[model samples]
Target: MKNEIRVIGGRFRSRKLRFPDAPGLRPTPDRVRETLFNWLRNDIEGARCLDLYAGSGALGFEAASRGASKVVQVEQDAAVCRALERNRALLNAEAVEIVQVEVRRFLAGEGQPFDLVFLDPPFRQGLVVPCCGALEENGWLSSSAKIYLEAEREFRLDGLPLNWRPLRGGKAGEVGYHLCERTFFR
Candidate 1:
């Protein structure tokens, strides 16, 4: 059976999205998303966003609903990417783009800096540090970009870029969610 989730706010509020059963495809919980966006209220509008490891495309689509100028959702699984495409079409999300690729490979290539980023990789695989390093080293972040990261509640976000400063964070159940902004002058 397919799993379903709803958009929490903005133009897509209450809209349901369906996705095939795929491993590690958990969508960000609605309450957590609401809090994350609240932390980003001032920065979300008109921002360009990147949703790395775009499971369920929740963060990317939410940014589009809230008026982000552009959003790129990168996911490796073919079925997951198709679901993301379906949701984008369903929402008429012209500002959003879905890419079927490995997150690290995408980051290795030339990057167009984004104003906001959602970096919610799968939990408990040592992905956070390497991905964070790639984003900072490969020119994927605009100066002063805001990044949202989600991981296992016990995961320690060590070895991240020095310039990325934690602005807000909280834990809900087993998930630890955080918002960080890239500082221009470290």
Candidate 2:
């Protein structure tokens, strides 16, 4: 069976996007998304975004809906990629691009700097830290970029980049969500 998620705010508010029931595919809950967007309200418009491990493309699509100039969604699963493409077409999201590739591979290649990033890798796979590092080291993040991360509630924040300061964070049941800002000290 397929599942659906709605865009909470912006031009596509209330529109629903469908996703396949693939293993390890957990979309960010609406409440958490609302809070994350609120934290980013001042910075989201016209920002370039990267949704790493874009399982359901919820975060990426939401960014586009809220006026992000560019949003790149990277997913490794073929089925999920198809679903994301369908959603993009359904919404006529010309600013949103769906890339079918592993998050690591996508990060390895050079890319334009992003003003915002969403990092919500699969639970229990230990992909978050390395992905954060790659974003920082591989030139994916612009200076002072904002990153939103979701993980198991018990996950620690010690692995995050040293320059990334926690701007806001909280837990919802088993999920931990955080919004961080990169502080360049040079």
Among all candidates shown, the one with the greatest lDDT: 2
Q: Report clashes for each candidate as comma-separated counts.
A: 0, 0
Clash pairs of candidate 2? none
Q: In model 2, which regions exceed 4 Å deviation?
A: none
Q: What is the RMSD of candidate 2?
A: 1.2
Q: What digit string (tens of lDDT, one per residue) describes model 2 on residues 14-57? A: 99999998888989988999999998988989999999889888
In model 2, which range of ten residues has the least summed lDDT?
Answer: 177-186
Residue ranges of candidate 1 with Cα displaced over 4 Å = none
Tens digit of lDDT per residue, candidate 1, span 1-186?
358888888999999998888887788888999999888888888999999999888899999999999999999999999989999999999999999999999999997899998989888889888988888888898989988899999977688899888988999999999888899844
In the predicted model 1, the residue pairs found to clash are none
lDDT of each: 0.89, 0.91
Quality of model 2 by C-alpha lDDT: 0.91
